[model samples]
Target chain A: MDYKQLQGRLRSNILKMHHGAGSGHIGCSLSCIDIMAAILKFKNEADTFILSKGHAATALYTILNETGAIPDEDLGTFYKNATTLPAHPAPLKYAAIPFATGSLGHGLPLATGIAKANKLKGNDKISFVLMSDGETNEGTSWEAAHFAVANKLDNLIAFVDCNGLQGFGNTADILGNTASPKLWEAMGFEVVECDGHDIEALMQAWKKLAANKNGKPKMVVASTVKGKGIKEMEDKMEWHYLPMTDAQYTAAKQEIRAGYGLEND
Target chain B: MRKHFSEYIERNLADREDFVFITGDLGYNALEGVAKKMGPRFINAGVAEQNMIGVAAGMASQGFQVLCYSIAPFVVYRCLEQMRNDVCFHNLPVYIAGNGGGYGYGIMGSSHHAIEDIATLSGLPNMQCYIPGFVEDMRATMDEMFARRRPAYLRLGLGKNLPADMQLVTGGTQTVLTPEARLTILSQGPVTNNLIAALAKSDKQNSIDVFTLNTMPFVTLPAALATSIATTKNILVIEEHISIGGLGSSLALLVNEAGLPLDKFISLHAEGYPNGLYGSQAYHQQVSGLGEENILRVINSYF
Candidate 1:
């Protein structure tokens, strides 16, 4: 798959879903779309992915729909009454999702275990756990970080959607200088820094980490702007929880079309 | 109890290919054999209880009968939300073996004690609470847990004081020391040892029956317990845990639901914090009103 095209489509779908669903994490979801696109590009049948920052269910649902793991029609029912696609990701209801995660700091530990299980079974499926910058503040995430290294879980690759903002405030304000790359490196991870919105850079990082086998887990600290595709909501805190209004949705679509060179409808 | 549990794990690992044991850097002397035998299957998840539970759930998700071993407080209290979300909510077959139930690690101070574990863990849905007072009970309960393949918490008290005639009742009660008595005293774990000793020394030893329940958070009362409750005027519950949510509270609920009337339904169990008591398990038991003398006094008050 052409990751740039997929990123554009994922961004468009995310905007539409936030507007249609009437409630979703639009900004944070948009921040990780390109990173997720790069992952989906290289993700094989053996590979499994977990979205630890589960408020971005719309982004994951859109990507799954694009990948054909989930039906396209189900995307329309996003966040609607009696819909399997709720505001948070429920993997049991959707086969594309592997683990149900919304609570912060759970994804890495669960992913570590999954990688461990795969190792025990002699399966080489690389378990990918995508977390948020704010999610790193949880103590459990650090525990998993330490455990992953101690167990030599080289098959696990963690992606930090370093959007810089959290639920309450900027991650810098809440947790000063969390510096995920340095933190992960100190915890014995082969840390890589990248522009999260740059699909080529993310794919390159994924390739290097997937092939590297130095007995240390890999972490890609992808620096990103919250609500990256749209100008109005970029790095704004309110967009974390707010769905796009009709005007905001129209503006976002036009911005994406203009920036990504999509044919204007 | 730890010795038998470790022996069982070692024996099972020889045959069961799917069994995985995880610990939070605990089981100092007891787990080395299991670790050596199982190799990579036995994982010490460090002191991180929350991550240990998540790891167990992850292993269990892939057709593994995972066992998480730790002290009662560390496993139950430290990682309750993980157990609820990762294990119980998903209904994974993860057997959490808590080594020090109640005041089993009493001299290690209040932090090591696990008095409120029963109350906290019992409230979770799809969870079975098992308190094994003897090695036989541990074997029987482990077999039942393995057969059932559900989420269970096995409370392992450190003290090994098994009553000579303590019957291994599967998912029910056992009349250990005294049977066919009009007055019944019920409890779980090694606390039953004190009850047994008290009953044996009492003048009304034949009149006061001593029964031990191996499992709790159960639906229906065992026929023997129900029958005992029907005939008894005085029923006393002595647990090493707190009064609110341990065996005492569960039995009260059963008695109320069964509509069994009695002159006295006394619950002699611990209540509130230990106030930084760093003494032996015996001292904690005495202060908590679960000592031999306290048991005899409560029995004499009614019987």
Candidate 2:
């Protein structure tokens, strides 16, 4: 599959969902679209992925819609009461989702447990959890990190969308002095750094981690720009909660098409 | 009883593939043997209650019967959100077993006390709360809870003063000491022993009925309990927990709602947190007004 084209389509679908609902985490969703696309390529009948940075549910829903894991009809009811995809990844709404995670700091522990269970049961399928950089601030996240290391969960892989901006402000200002990659390294994880928007680099990182026999949980710090596809909204914190007006939606659509060279394809 | 409970799980370890015992570094004297016996199935989660709960929930989600155990306060208080969200919300068969109910860890001070756990856990959806009054009762419940295999919370006491031949009740209240008495004393765990001792001292042991309630979140009074209430309009509920939302409060509501003729309803329970009082379990019980003398006084007042 052409992953770059898939990323563009997911970004477009996410924009449409946010515009249709009139409310959603557009910036966070856009930042993790490429990472989600890359990880979806690894998902098979047994492997599972948990979106710990659940504010980016739109991006995951869009990917699931594209990959045929979820019915395309469910995409139209995003963030509406008419469908179970109500702003966060609720597994009850879609059984294809392995577990529900909207509250921050819960996803890593749940993923660690699942990975540990699979290891105990001798299942070879890998379990992946994608989280936000700002989510590392929660104490439970650190507890789960320590737990994953102590248990030696070699089957577990975590990806952090390092978008630099959170709901409050830049992550650098809110979380003082501790870089997420270094922190994971200090906690005894085999850390990998990659360009968040580079699908090829992400695939390579995943492959390298899966091949390593070092018996440590792996964390990939995918450095990304929030609102990657839009010119005016990129890296802007206000866009985290901002809904697009009709004019802004039209302009975003035009910009995405022009940027991806799909305007006259 | 803690040792016995662990031994029960240990004895059945080889037979059951679905059972997994996890602790947050608790069960110092009770669980070491079970841990050694169960091998990979026994997890010591290392003082991380929140993570341990999530881990239990995750394992249960995959069809494993998980028991997340620790001291009373740490097991329920620190990780309640995970229990409510991850375990109860999914309705998974996760058994949250807290080792010290009420003042079980008394001299360890307020941080260790779990005087209000019943209220906290009972309010959650799909949670079955069990406070076992004797070692026999705890043994029976351990089997039944795992047999049914649903979401549950087991509040264990300090394992003292167990009656050898008392017939235990599983799903509702059981009148243990007195059968055909008019004034009934409703109590829980080892606190019932204290009430029995107090009543024995007053020579009213046979005249006064003592009933124990170990099953909750199935708070409906069974026919036997209702029948016990029918013979007696005067009821005194004594629990080691605080009165608010404890057995006392719940029984009051149950008795009143059941429309049993009631001349007097009294609950003898700990008032609230035992603030700044550091002493033995008995001393803490005394400070909370759960002492035998105080309970006898309350029961007398009700009559």
Candidate 2 on A1-265: residue-level lDDT in tens?
A: 3566667777888998999999858999999999988888665657778898888889988888887888878888888886878888775556557777888888888888888788778878788889898888878878888888988988889999998887698888987624377878999899999999999889889878977868899998999999999988999998888899999999998888878756433
lDDT of 1 by residue, A98-195 (tens): 67788888888888888888888888789898999888888888888888999898999999998888889988889864646777898899999999
Q: Candidate 2 DockQ category? A: medium
- Per-residue alpha-carbon lDDT of model 2 for B1-303, expressed as tens digits? 677778888887534667788889888778878888788888888989999998888778777889888888998888888988788878888888888788888888788888889888888878888888777777777778888787899988766545543466655335464455668777877677777667756755555666787877547876666777788777888788887778878887888788889877877776655476588788888777778888777766654
Alpha carbon lDDT of each predicted model: 0.82, 0.81
Clashing residue pairs, backbone N/CA/C < 3 A, model 1:
none
TM-score of each: 0.93, 0.94
Reference contacts preserved by each model: 0.46, 0.50
Q: Which stretches of candidate 1 lie over 4 Å from their true place?
A: A1-4, A261-265, B159-166, B176-181, B273-276
lDDT of 1 at B8: 90
Error at A189, model 2, angstroms: 1.0
